[model samples]
Target: MGVRWILAAGLWLAGCATSPPPSGLPDSLDVSSRHELTEVPFFPQRDYQCGPASLAMTLAWSGLKVTPEDLKPQVYSAKREGSLPPDMIAAARRRGRIAYPVTSTADLLREVAAGHPVIVLQRLESFWQTQWHYAVVIGYDLERREIVLHSGAEERLAMALDAFEQTWKPWGYWGLVTMDPRRLPASAEPKKYVKAVLGLERTQRWQEAEQAYSSALARWPHHLTAWIGLGNSRYALGNLAGAEQAFRSAVRAKPDSGIPYNNLAHVLMEMNRTEEALAVIRQAIRLGGPQISVYKKTLAEIQRRRNS
Candidate 1:
Protein backbone atom coordinates (compact mmCIF):
# COMPACT_ATOMS: atom_id res chain seq x y z
CA MET A 1 0.00 0.00 0.00
CA GLY A 2 0.96 3.64 -0.47
CA VAL A 3 2.53 5.53 2.46
CA ARG A 4 -0.35 7.99 2.90
CA TRP A 5 -3.01 5.33 2.85
CA ILE A 6 -1.04 3.33 5.35
CA LEU A 7 -0.75 6.32 7.67
CA ALA A 8 -4.47 7.07 7.41
CA ALA A 9 -5.37 3.48 8.14
CA GLY A 10 -3.02 3.51 11.12
CA LEU A 11 -4.67 6.66 12.46
CA TRP A 12 -8.07 5.04 12.11
CA LEU A 13 -6.99 1.79 13.68
CA ALA A 14 -5.29 3.53 16.59
CA GLY A 15 -8.50 5.40 17.37
CA CYS A 16 -6.33 8.53 17.12
CA ALA A 17 -8.38 11.27 18.79
CA THR A 18 -10.12 8.77 21.03
CA SER A 19 -7.12 7.61 23.04
CA PRO A 20 -7.68 7.89 26.77
CA PRO A 21 -5.19 9.35 29.22
CA PRO A 22 -2.56 6.83 30.32
CA SER A 23 -3.76 4.60 33.16
CA GLY A 24 -2.67 4.34 36.83
CA LEU A 25 -1.91 7.99 37.45
CA PRO A 26 -3.62 11.34 37.55
CA ASP A 27 -2.16 13.97 35.21
CA SER A 28 -1.33 16.45 37.97
CA LEU A 29 2.01 15.50 39.46
CA ASP A 30 4.77 18.12 39.39
CA VAL A 31 7.06 17.01 36.58
CA SER A 32 10.06 18.97 37.77
CA SER A 33 12.14 16.94 40.21
CA ARG A 34 9.78 13.95 40.14
CA HIS A 35 12.58 11.69 41.38
CA GLU A 36 12.77 8.85 38.89
CA LEU A 37 15.59 6.29 38.98
CA THR A 38 18.69 7.34 36.98
CA GLU A 39 20.19 4.30 35.27
CA VAL A 40 19.35 1.73 32.62
CA PRO A 41 19.10 -1.73 34.12
CA PHE A 42 19.40 -3.44 30.74
CA PHE A 43 20.86 -1.57 27.82
CA PRO A 44 21.14 -3.80 24.76
CA GLN A 45 24.67 -5.00 24.07
CA ARG A 46 24.32 -4.32 20.36
CA ASP A 47 23.00 -1.16 18.74
CA TYR A 48 19.40 -1.69 17.68
CA GLN A 49 18.94 -1.29 13.95
CA CYS A 50 16.40 1.27 12.67
CA GLY A 51 13.00 0.47 11.07
CA PRO A 52 9.59 0.16 12.73
CA ALA A 53 9.47 -3.62 12.93
CA SER A 54 13.06 -3.88 14.05
CA LEU A 55 12.54 -1.29 16.78
CA ALA A 56 9.34 -2.95 18.00
CA MET A 57 11.00 -6.33 18.14
CA THR A 58 14.05 -4.96 19.92
CA LEU A 59 11.95 -3.21 22.55
CA ALA A 60 9.98 -6.40 23.08
CA TRP A 61 13.13 -8.46 23.40
CA SER A 62 14.58 -5.85 25.77
CA GLY A 63 11.82 -6.67 28.28
CA LEU A 64 8.99 -4.34 27.25
CA LYS A 65 7.30 -7.66 26.40
CA VAL A 66 5.02 -6.39 23.61
CA THR A 67 5.53 -7.71 20.11
CA PRO A 68 5.17 -6.13 16.67
CA GLU A 69 2.06 -8.29 16.28
CA ASP A 70 0.61 -6.65 19.37
CA LEU A 71 1.33 -3.23 17.95
CA LYS A 72 0.16 -4.35 14.52
CA PRO A 73 -3.35 -5.11 15.74
CA GLN A 74 -3.61 -1.58 17.11
CA VAL A 75 -2.24 0.26 14.06
CA TYR A 76 -2.29 -0.23 10.28
CA SER A 77 -1.20 -3.64 8.99
CA ALA A 78 1.07 -2.24 6.27
CA LYS A 79 3.66 -0.50 8.41
CA ARG A 80 2.34 2.87 9.58
CA GLU A 81 4.75 5.64 8.78
CA GLY A 82 5.40 8.73 10.99
CA SER A 83 4.16 9.09 14.59
CA LEU A 84 3.08 6.05 16.56
CA PRO A 85 -0.62 5.25 17.01
CA PRO A 86 -2.51 6.22 20.12
CA ASP A 87 -3.60 2.63 20.59
CA MET A 88 0.05 1.68 20.71
CA ILE A 89 0.46 4.31 23.37
CA ALA A 90 -2.46 2.85 25.30
CA ALA A 91 -0.97 -0.64 25.08
CA ALA A 92 2.38 0.65 26.36
CA ARG A 93 0.63 2.42 29.21
CA ARG A 94 -1.20 -0.76 30.08
CA ARG A 95 2.16 -2.45 30.31
CA GLY A 96 3.42 0.47 32.45
CA ARG A 97 5.37 2.21 29.69
CA ILE A 98 4.78 5.86 28.77
CA ALA A 99 4.11 6.59 25.10
CA TYR A 100 3.84 9.79 23.02
CA PRO A 101 4.05 10.31 19.28
CA VAL A 102 5.43 13.82 19.51
CA THR A 103 4.87 16.12 16.51
CA SER A 104 6.35 19.33 17.84
CA THR A 105 8.27 20.83 20.77
CA ALA A 106 4.95 21.92 22.24
CA ASP A 107 3.73 18.34 22.26
CA LEU A 108 6.87 17.34 24.15
CA LEU A 109 6.33 20.06 26.76
CA ARG A 110 2.69 19.09 27.23
CA GLU A 111 3.63 15.49 27.89
CA VAL A 112 6.22 16.62 30.41
CA ALA A 113 3.55 18.74 32.11
CA ALA A 114 1.37 15.66 32.47
CA GLY A 115 4.01 14.08 34.71
CA HIS A 116 4.83 11.41 32.16
CA PRO A 117 8.31 10.65 30.80
CA VAL A 118 8.82 11.24 27.08
CA ILE A 119 10.90 9.69 24.31
CA VAL A 120 11.58 11.37 20.98
CA LEU A 121 12.94 9.87 17.81
CA GLN A 122 14.22 12.48 15.37
CA ARG A 123 15.83 12.63 11.94
CA LEU A 124 18.95 14.77 12.19
CA GLU A 125 21.65 16.02 9.84
CA SER A 126 24.88 14.10 10.43
CA PHE A 127 28.48 15.27 9.89
CA TRP A 128 28.42 13.68 6.45
CA GLN A 129 25.69 16.14 5.38
CA THR A 130 23.18 13.32 5.26
CA GLN A 131 20.18 12.84 7.47
CA TRP A 132 20.37 10.16 10.16
CA HIS A 133 17.87 9.02 12.76
CA TYR A 134 18.34 9.42 16.52
CA ALA A 135 16.13 8.91 19.56
CA VAL A 136 15.98 10.90 22.82
CA VAL A 137 13.32 12.36 25.10
CA ILE A 138 12.61 14.31 28.22
CA GLY A 139 13.59 11.94 31.02
CA TYR A 140 13.24 14.43 33.89
CA ASP A 141 13.32 18.01 35.06
CA LEU A 142 15.63 19.51 37.64
CA GLU A 143 13.76 22.80 37.16
CA ARG A 144 10.32 23.82 35.98
CA ARG A 145 9.78 23.08 32.30
CA GLU A 146 13.54 22.63 32.02
CA ILE A 147 13.80 18.96 31.18
CA VAL A 148 16.37 16.20 30.73
CA LEU A 149 16.42 13.76 27.83
CA HIS A 150 18.18 10.51 26.91
CA SER A 151 19.92 11.78 23.78
CA GLY A 152 22.33 9.53 21.91
CA ALA A 153 25.95 10.11 23.07
CA GLU A 154 24.76 11.52 26.42
CA GLU A 155 21.94 12.92 28.55
CA ARG A 156 20.90 16.59 28.07
CA LEU A 157 19.47 18.98 30.61
CA ALA A 158 17.91 22.44 31.09
CA MET A 159 15.89 22.25 27.92
CA ALA A 160 12.43 23.65 27.52
CA LEU A 161 10.59 20.71 25.99
CA ASP A 162 8.58 22.99 23.75
CA ALA A 163 11.70 24.72 22.51
CA PHE A 164 13.49 21.47 21.93
CA GLU A 165 10.57 19.91 20.12
CA GLN A 166 10.17 22.89 17.82
CA THR A 167 13.88 23.18 17.28
CA TRP A 168 14.08 19.57 16.17
CA LYS A 169 11.06 19.48 13.82
CA PRO A 170 13.08 20.26 10.71
CA TRP A 171 13.94 16.62 11.18
CA GLY A 172 11.08 14.09 11.13
CA TYR A 173 9.30 12.96 14.28
CA TRP A 174 9.42 9.17 14.35
CA GLY A 175 8.08 8.48 17.91
CA LEU A 176 8.75 8.49 21.63
CA VAL A 177 9.92 5.77 24.10
CA THR A 178 9.26 6.11 27.77
CA MET A 179 8.66 4.28 31.05
CA ASP A 180 7.42 5.12 34.51
CA PRO A 181 9.81 6.74 36.98
CA ARG A 182 9.82 3.62 39.13
CA ARG A 183 10.41 1.30 36.18
CA LEU A 184 13.26 3.30 34.57
CA PRO A 185 16.59 1.46 34.46
CA ALA A 186 19.25 2.74 36.84
CA SER A 187 22.05 2.53 34.27
CA ALA A 188 19.93 4.54 31.83
CA GLU A 189 18.76 7.14 34.28
CA PRO A 190 20.08 10.74 34.31
CA LYS A 191 20.45 10.69 30.56
CA LYS A 192 21.61 14.30 30.59
CA TYR A 193 24.83 13.30 32.31
CA VAL A 194 25.91 11.34 29.27
CA LYS A 195 24.45 13.81 26.77
CA ALA A 196 26.31 16.69 28.33
CA VAL A 197 29.59 14.94 27.81
CA LEU A 198 28.88 14.24 24.13
CA GLY A 199 27.61 17.76 23.59
CA LEU A 200 30.87 19.16 24.91
CA GLU A 201 32.79 17.01 22.47
CA ARG A 202 30.64 18.18 19.57
CA THR A 203 31.33 21.81 20.49
CA GLN A 204 35.07 21.19 21.02
CA ARG A 205 34.61 21.67 24.73
CA TRP A 206 37.81 19.68 25.17
CA GLN A 207 38.47 19.54 28.91
CA GLU A 208 34.88 18.89 29.88
CA ALA A 209 34.50 16.53 26.96
CA GLU A 210 37.44 14.44 28.10
CA GLN A 211 35.96 13.96 31.57
CA ALA A 212 32.52 13.14 30.16
CA TYR A 213 33.98 10.67 27.70
CA SER A 214 35.84 8.96 30.52
CA SER A 215 32.69 8.63 32.61
CA ALA A 216 30.63 7.22 29.76
CA LEU A 217 33.42 4.77 28.91
CA ALA A 218 33.34 3.57 32.47
CA ARG A 219 29.66 2.82 32.08
CA TRP A 220 29.55 1.62 28.47
CA PRO A 221 32.97 0.21 27.71
CA HIS A 222 32.29 -0.93 24.19
CA HIS A 223 30.65 2.25 22.89
CA LEU A 224 32.59 2.81 19.64
CA THR A 225 32.06 6.56 19.41
CA ALA A 226 33.18 7.09 22.98
CA TRP A 227 36.39 5.26 22.31
CA ILE A 228 37.05 7.26 19.14
CA GLY A 229 36.33 10.52 20.85
CA LEU A 230 38.49 9.58 23.83
CA GLY A 231 41.38 8.72 21.57
CA ASN A 232 41.08 11.90 19.55
CA SER A 233 40.87 13.99 22.68
CA ARG A 234 43.88 12.28 24.21
CA TYR A 235 45.86 12.81 21.02
CA ALA A 236 45.00 16.49 21.13
CA LEU A 237 46.05 16.59 24.79
CA GLY A 238 49.43 15.00 23.86
CA ASN A 239 48.86 11.62 25.53
CA LEU A 240 50.17 9.37 22.73
CA ALA A 241 49.84 6.03 24.50
CA GLY A 242 46.33 6.79 25.71
CA ALA A 243 45.32 7.96 22.25
CA GLU A 244 46.86 4.88 20.58
CA GLN A 245 45.02 2.52 22.91
CA ALA A 246 41.71 4.33 22.38
CA PHE A 247 42.00 4.25 18.58
CA ARG A 248 42.93 0.57 18.62
CA SER A 249 39.83 -0.24 20.67
CA ALA A 250 37.64 1.78 18.31
CA VAL A 251 38.96 -0.05 15.22
CA ARG A 252 38.41 -3.41 16.93
CA ALA A 253 34.83 -2.57 17.87
CA LYS A 254 33.88 -1.27 14.41
CA PRO A 255 36.18 -2.45 11.68
CA ASP A 256 34.01 -1.32 8.80
CA SER A 257 33.93 2.41 9.49
CA GLY A 258 36.68 4.17 7.52
CA ILE A 259 37.07 7.18 9.82
CA PRO A 260 38.84 5.21 12.54
CA TYR A 261 41.10 3.63 9.95
CA ASN A 262 42.09 7.04 8.64
CA ASN A 263 42.59 8.43 12.12
CA LEU A 264 44.66 5.44 13.17
CA ALA A 265 46.76 5.75 10.04
CA HIS A 266 47.61 9.34 10.86
CA VAL A 267 48.59 8.39 14.39
CA LEU A 268 50.70 5.47 13.14
CA MET A 269 52.56 7.74 10.74
CA GLU A 270 53.28 10.18 13.58
CA MET A 271 54.65 7.28 15.62
CA ASN A 272 57.00 6.35 12.69
CA ARG A 273 55.10 3.19 11.74
CA THR A 274 55.10 4.18 8.07
CA GLU A 275 54.53 0.70 6.72
CA GLU A 276 51.68 0.05 9.12
CA ALA A 277 50.20 3.43 8.29
CA LEU A 278 50.35 2.71 4.55
CA ALA A 279 48.59 -0.63 5.10
CA VAL A 280 45.83 1.07 7.10
CA ILE A 281 45.42 3.77 4.44
CA ARG A 282 45.03 1.06 1.78
CA GLN A 283 42.36 -0.67 3.91
CA ALA A 284 40.49 2.63 4.28
CA ILE A 285 40.54 3.10 0.49
CA ARG A 286 39.02 -0.35 0.09
CA LEU A 287 36.33 0.48 2.67
CA GLY A 288 35.12 3.66 0.90
CA GLY A 289 36.81 6.24 3.05
CA PRO A 290 35.29 9.72 3.08
CA GLN A 291 38.64 11.43 2.49
CA ILE A 292 39.47 9.63 -0.73
CA SER A 293 41.29 12.63 -2.25
CA VAL A 294 43.11 13.37 0.99
CA TYR A 295 44.05 9.72 1.30
CA LYS A 296 45.49 9.74 -2.24
CA LYS A 297 47.50 12.89 -1.52
CA THR A 298 48.78 11.56 1.80
CA LEU A 299 49.77 8.24 0.24
CA ALA A 300 51.80 10.07 -2.43
CA GLU A 301 53.53 12.16 0.25
CA ILE A 302 54.27 9.00 2.25
CA GLN A 303 55.86 7.33 -0.80
CA ARG A 304 58.02 10.43 -1.47
CA ARG A 305 59.15 10.51 2.17
CA ARG A 306 60.08 6.81 2.06
CA ASN A 307 62.13 7.32 -1.15
CA SER A 308 63.92 10.32 0.43
Candidate 2:
Protein backbone atom coordinates (compact mmCIF):
# COMPACT_ATOMS: atom_id res chain seq x y z
CA MET A 1 0.00 0.00 0.00
CA GLY A 2 1.17 3.51 -0.78
CA VAL A 3 2.22 5.55 2.24
CA ARG A 4 0.03 8.45 3.30
CA TRP A 5 2.22 11.37 4.37
CA ILE A 6 0.67 14.34 6.18
CA LEU A 7 2.51 17.34 7.54
CA ALA A 8 2.55 17.58 11.32
CA ALA A 9 1.34 20.80 12.86
CA GLY A 10 3.73 22.78 15.01
CA LEU A 11 3.62 21.68 18.61
CA TRP A 12 1.78 24.24 20.71
CA LEU A 13 3.65 24.35 23.99
CA ALA A 14 1.90 27.15 25.78
CA GLY A 15 2.09 26.60 29.52
CA CYS A 16 3.88 23.32 28.86
CA ALA A 17 5.17 23.39 32.40
CA THR A 18 1.60 23.34 33.65
CA SER A 19 0.13 21.03 31.07
CA PRO A 20 -2.78 19.02 32.42
CA PRO A 21 -2.48 15.34 33.13
CA PRO A 22 -3.62 12.82 30.57
CA SER A 23 -7.23 11.70 30.40
CA GLY A 24 -8.49 8.06 30.38
CA LEU A 25 -6.05 7.11 33.12
CA PRO A 26 -7.04 6.15 36.66
CA ASP A 27 -8.82 8.95 38.57
CA SER A 28 -5.90 9.26 40.93
CA LEU A 29 -3.83 10.53 38.03
CA ASP A 30 -6.36 12.91 36.53
CA VAL A 31 -5.72 16.66 36.76
CA SER A 32 -8.77 18.78 37.25
CA SER A 33 -9.94 20.75 34.20
CA ARG A 34 -11.23 23.64 36.35
CA HIS A 35 -13.85 24.13 33.69
CA GLU A 36 -17.37 23.42 34.81
CA LEU A 37 -19.69 21.19 32.87
CA THR A 38 -22.48 23.56 32.08
CA GLU A 39 -23.69 22.39 28.70
CA VAL A 40 -23.70 18.54 28.65
CA PRO A 41 -26.97 16.85 29.46
CA PHE A 42 -27.28 14.09 32.04
CA PHE A 43 -29.69 11.29 31.24
CA PRO A 44 -30.41 7.95 32.84
CA GLN A 45 -30.02 5.32 30.18
CA ARG A 46 -29.61 1.58 30.36
CA ASP A 47 -27.25 1.60 27.34
CA TYR A 48 -25.52 3.85 24.82
CA GLN A 49 -26.43 3.12 21.19
CA CYS A 50 -23.74 4.89 19.12
CA GLY A 51 -20.05 5.72 19.72
CA PRO A 52 -16.90 6.79 17.88
CA ALA A 53 -15.97 3.29 16.77
CA SER A 54 -19.49 2.54 15.61
CA LEU A 55 -19.60 5.81 13.66
CA ALA A 56 -16.24 5.12 12.07
CA MET A 57 -17.32 1.62 11.16
CA THR A 58 -20.60 2.82 9.71
CA LEU A 59 -18.79 5.37 7.57
CA ALA A 60 -16.25 2.86 6.32
CA TRP A 61 -18.92 0.32 5.43
CA SER A 62 -20.66 3.06 3.53
CA GLY A 63 -17.45 3.50 1.49
CA LEU A 64 -16.55 6.75 3.21
CA LYS A 65 -13.01 7.03 4.49
CA VAL A 66 -12.56 9.14 7.62
CA THR A 67 -9.04 10.28 8.37
CA PRO A 68 -7.82 11.32 11.80
CA GLU A 69 -7.59 14.88 10.52
CA ASP A 70 -11.25 14.84 9.53
CA LEU A 71 -12.53 13.90 12.97
CA LYS A 72 -10.69 16.60 14.91
CA PRO A 73 -12.87 18.03 17.65
CA GLN A 74 -12.72 21.37 15.85
CA VAL A 75 -13.95 19.82 12.59
CA TYR A 76 -16.92 18.24 14.33
CA SER A 77 -17.62 21.51 16.10
CA ALA A 78 -17.54 23.31 12.77
CA LYS A 79 -19.92 20.80 11.26
CA ARG A 80 -22.23 21.22 14.22
CA GLU A 81 -22.21 25.01 13.90
CA GLY A 82 -23.30 24.64 10.23
CA SER A 83 -19.95 25.88 8.95
CA LEU A 84 -19.68 22.84 6.67
CA PRO A 85 -22.12 21.10 4.39
CA PRO A 86 -23.64 17.78 5.40
CA ASP A 87 -21.88 16.08 2.51
CA MET A 88 -21.46 12.85 4.44
CA ILE A 89 -25.19 12.59 5.01
CA ALA A 90 -26.09 13.54 1.44
CA ALA A 91 -23.51 11.17 0.05
CA ALA A 92 -24.78 8.21 2.05
CA ARG A 93 -28.46 8.96 1.50
CA ARG A 94 -27.85 9.06 -2.24
CA ARG A 95 -26.89 5.41 -1.96
CA GLY A 96 -30.15 4.77 -0.02
CA ARG A 97 -28.26 5.04 3.24
CA ILE A 98 -29.77 6.41 6.44
CA ALA A 99 -27.54 8.53 8.61
CA TYR A 100 -27.12 12.09 9.88
CA PRO A 101 -24.62 14.30 11.69
CA VAL A 102 -26.24 16.01 14.60
CA THR A 103 -24.68 18.94 16.50
CA SER A 104 -27.27 19.08 19.21
CA THR A 105 -29.85 16.89 20.90
CA ALA A 106 -32.46 19.02 19.18
CA ASP A 107 -31.14 17.81 15.86
CA LEU A 108 -31.38 14.19 16.96
CA LEU A 109 -34.89 14.75 18.24
CA ARG A 110 -35.83 16.24 14.92
CA GLU A 111 -34.64 13.12 13.15
CA VAL A 112 -36.42 10.94 15.67
CA ALA A 113 -39.56 13.00 15.17
CA ALA A 114 -39.34 12.33 11.44
CA GLY A 115 -39.34 8.58 12.13
CA HIS A 116 -35.90 8.18 10.66
CA PRO A 117 -33.14 6.08 12.18
CA VAL A 118 -30.54 8.35 13.76
CA ILE A 119 -26.98 7.94 14.87
CA VAL A 120 -25.72 10.54 17.32
CA LEU A 121 -22.39 11.32 19.01
CA GLN A 122 -22.74 12.85 22.41
CA ARG A 123 -20.29 13.88 25.13
CA LEU A 124 -21.01 11.99 28.31
CA GLU A 125 -19.60 11.46 31.80
CA SER A 126 -19.91 8.08 33.41
CA PHE A 127 -21.84 8.59 36.63
CA TRP A 128 -19.86 5.96 38.45
CA GLN A 129 -16.45 7.19 37.28
CA THR A 130 -17.19 10.83 36.43
CA GLN A 131 -14.99 10.33 33.44
CA TRP A 132 -15.89 11.67 30.05
CA HIS A 133 -16.99 9.20 27.37
CA TYR A 134 -18.17 9.82 23.84
CA ALA A 135 -21.31 7.80 23.08
CA VAL A 136 -23.43 7.13 20.04
CA VAL A 137 -27.18 7.66 20.09
CA ILE A 138 -28.68 4.84 18.04
CA GLY A 139 -32.42 4.82 18.61
CA TYR A 140 -35.16 6.30 20.74
CA ASP A 141 -38.46 5.22 22.23
CA LEU A 142 -41.04 7.97 21.88
CA GLU A 143 -43.41 6.42 24.37
CA ARG A 144 -40.80 6.44 27.07
CA ARG A 145 -39.24 9.65 25.72
CA GLU A 146 -35.90 7.90 26.09
CA ILE A 147 -32.93 8.15 23.71
CA VAL A 148 -31.25 4.85 22.97
CA LEU A 149 -27.47 4.54 22.62
CA HIS A 150 -24.63 2.04 22.28
CA SER A 151 -22.34 2.40 25.25
CA GLY A 152 -18.75 1.14 24.77
CA ALA A 153 -19.48 -2.28 26.25
CA GLU A 154 -23.13 -2.07 27.16
CA GLU A 155 -24.21 -2.80 23.56
CA ARG A 156 -27.48 -0.83 23.78
CA LEU A 157 -29.59 1.15 26.27
CA ALA A 158 -32.25 3.84 26.54
CA MET A 159 -32.48 7.13 28.44
CA ALA A 160 -34.67 10.18 28.57
CA LEU A 161 -33.41 12.46 25.76
CA ASP A 162 -33.80 15.68 27.74
CA ALA A 163 -31.81 14.43 30.68
CA PHE A 164 -29.14 12.87 28.49
CA GLU A 165 -28.80 16.05 26.45
CA GLN A 166 -28.43 18.19 29.55
CA THR A 167 -25.60 16.02 30.82
CA TRP A 168 -23.83 15.73 27.48
CA LYS A 169 -24.20 19.20 26.00
CA PRO A 170 -21.36 20.61 28.04
CA TRP A 171 -18.90 18.29 26.38
CA GLY A 172 -20.24 19.27 22.95
CA TYR A 173 -23.35 17.74 21.42
CA TRP A 174 -21.38 16.70 18.31
CA GLY A 175 -22.75 13.47 16.79
CA LEU A 176 -23.10 11.90 13.35
CA VAL A 177 -23.58 8.44 11.89
CA THR A 178 -25.50 6.01 9.59
CA MET A 179 -28.31 3.67 10.59
CA ASP A 180 -27.71 0.76 8.21
CA PRO A 181 -25.10 -1.93 8.82
CA ARG A 182 -23.92 -1.32 5.26
CA ARG A 183 -22.72 2.07 6.42
CA LEU A 184 -20.42 0.60 9.06
CA PRO A 185 -16.73 0.04 8.39
CA ALA A 186 -15.29 -3.33 7.47
CA SER A 187 -13.50 -3.10 10.81
CA ALA A 188 -14.01 -0.55 13.56
CA GLU A 189 -11.00 -1.94 15.37
CA PRO A 190 -8.38 0.33 13.80
CA LYS A 191 -10.29 3.50 14.59
CA LYS A 192 -10.87 2.28 18.13
CA TYR A 193 -7.16 1.69 18.62
CA VAL A 194 -6.28 5.08 17.22
CA LYS A 195 -8.64 6.81 19.64
CA ALA A 196 -7.25 4.89 22.58
CA VAL A 197 -3.73 6.03 21.68
CA LEU A 198 -4.77 9.66 21.38
CA GLY A 199 -6.61 9.53 24.68
CA LEU A 200 -3.45 8.28 26.34
CA GLU A 201 -1.22 10.87 24.66
CA ARG A 202 -3.50 13.79 25.51
CA THR A 203 -3.40 12.91 29.18
CA GLN A 204 0.44 12.93 29.20
CA ARG A 205 0.82 9.38 30.46
CA TRP A 206 4.03 8.88 28.53
CA GLN A 207 4.53 5.18 29.20
CA GLU A 208 0.95 4.18 28.54
CA ALA A 209 0.89 6.62 25.64
CA GLU A 210 3.93 4.95 24.13
CA GLN A 211 2.45 1.48 24.57
CA ALA A 212 -0.88 2.50 23.07
CA TYR A 213 0.86 4.11 20.14
CA SER A 214 3.01 1.02 19.67
CA SER A 215 -0.07 -1.17 19.72
CA ALA A 216 -1.69 1.02 17.05
CA LEU A 217 1.42 0.69 14.89
CA ALA A 218 1.24 -3.07 15.22
CA ARG A 219 -2.21 -2.87 13.64
CA TRP A 220 -1.73 -0.02 11.16
CA PRO A 221 1.96 0.48 10.75
CA HIS A 222 1.55 3.37 8.34
CA HIS A 223 -0.67 5.37 10.65
CA LEU A 224 0.94 8.83 10.52
CA THR A 225 -0.38 10.05 13.86
CA ALA A 226 0.94 6.98 15.61
CA TRP A 227 4.40 7.58 14.19
CA ILE A 228 4.17 11.27 15.04
CA GLY A 229 3.15 10.57 18.63
CA LEU A 230 5.83 7.92 18.98
CA GLY A 231 8.42 10.35 17.63
CA ASN A 232 7.16 13.17 19.85
CA SER A 233 7.18 11.13 23.02
CA ARG A 234 10.65 9.82 22.27
CA TYR A 235 11.90 13.35 21.67
CA ALA A 236 10.32 14.53 24.91
CA LEU A 237 12.03 11.70 26.76
CA GLY A 238 15.45 12.68 25.26
CA ASN A 239 15.67 9.58 23.10
CA LEU A 240 16.92 11.44 20.04
CA ALA A 241 17.85 8.31 18.10
CA GLY A 242 14.41 6.78 18.58
CA ALA A 243 12.80 10.15 17.89
CA GLU A 244 14.73 10.51 14.62
CA GLN A 245 13.60 7.10 13.45
CA ALA A 246 9.97 7.81 14.27
CA PHE A 247 10.05 11.19 12.49
CA ARG A 248 11.72 9.64 9.48
CA SER A 249 9.04 6.99 9.36
CA ALA A 250 6.42 9.72 9.48
CA VAL A 251 8.10 11.57 6.61
CA ARG A 252 8.26 8.35 4.61
CA ALA A 253 4.61 7.76 5.38
CA LYS A 254 3.44 11.25 4.36
CA PRO A 255 6.06 12.88 2.17
CA ASP A 256 3.72 15.73 1.32
CA SER A 257 3.29 16.83 4.92
CA GLY A 258 5.66 19.59 6.02
CA ILE A 259 5.21 18.80 9.70
CA PRO A 260 7.60 15.89 9.65
CA TYR A 261 10.06 17.98 7.71
CA ASN A 262 9.99 20.76 10.28
CA ASN A 263 10.17 18.29 13.14
CA LEU A 264 13.02 16.41 11.49
CA ALA A 265 14.90 19.67 11.08
CA HIS A 266 14.44 20.43 14.76
CA VAL A 267 15.85 17.04 15.67
CA LEU A 268 18.77 17.47 13.29
CA MET A 269 19.61 20.80 14.90
CA GLU A 270 19.54 19.19 18.31
CA MET A 271 22.11 16.69 17.01
CA ASN A 272 24.25 19.64 15.67
CA ARG A 273 23.69 18.49 12.08
CA THR A 274 23.57 22.12 10.93
CA GLU A 275 23.96 21.68 7.19
CA GLU A 276 21.32 18.97 7.04
CA ALA A 277 19.10 20.88 9.46
CA LEU A 278 19.23 23.96 7.23
CA ALA A 279 18.23 21.92 4.21
CA VAL A 280 15.34 20.24 6.00
CA ILE A 281 14.07 23.49 7.46
CA ARG A 282 14.13 24.96 3.97
CA GLN A 283 12.05 22.02 2.79
CA ALA A 284 9.62 22.60 5.64
CA ILE A 285 9.31 26.25 4.67
CA ARG A 286 8.78 25.25 1.06
CA LEU A 287 6.00 22.94 2.21
CA GLY A 288 4.29 25.74 4.19
CA GLY A 289 5.36 25.14 7.76
CA PRO A 290 4.48 28.05 10.01
CA GLN A 291 6.49 30.55 12.05
CA ILE A 292 8.68 31.81 9.27
CA SER A 293 10.08 34.32 11.71
CA VAL A 294 11.15 31.54 14.04
CA TYR A 295 12.74 29.67 11.19
CA LYS A 296 14.69 32.78 10.19
CA LYS A 297 15.68 33.30 13.82
CA THR A 298 16.88 29.70 13.98
CA LEU A 299 18.85 30.14 10.77
CA ALA A 300 20.60 33.17 12.27
CA GLU A 301 21.34 31.20 15.43
CA ILE A 302 22.75 28.31 13.35
CA GLN A 303 24.98 30.72 11.42
CA ARG A 304 26.18 32.27 14.70
CA ARG A 305 26.90 28.85 16.20
CA ARG A 306 28.86 27.84 13.12
CA ASN A 307 30.92 31.08 13.03
CA SER A 308 31.68 30.88 16.75
Best by lDDT: 2
Task: Show model 2 residue runs off by greater than 4 Å.
Answer: 1-196, 289-301, 304-308
Question: TM-score for all predictions?
Answer: 0.40, 0.40
- Model 1 lowest lDDT segment of ten: 1-10
Look at candidate 1 and tell me the lDDT of residue 235.
69
Q: TM-score for model 2? A: 0.40
- Candidate 1 lDDT over 227-266, as tens digits, reads 7777777766767778778778878978986666766776
- Report the lDDT tens digits of candidate 2 across residue range 124-174: 445443333444455655446566655555445567657676655653454
Cα displacement (angstroms), candidate 2, residue 228, comes to: 1.7
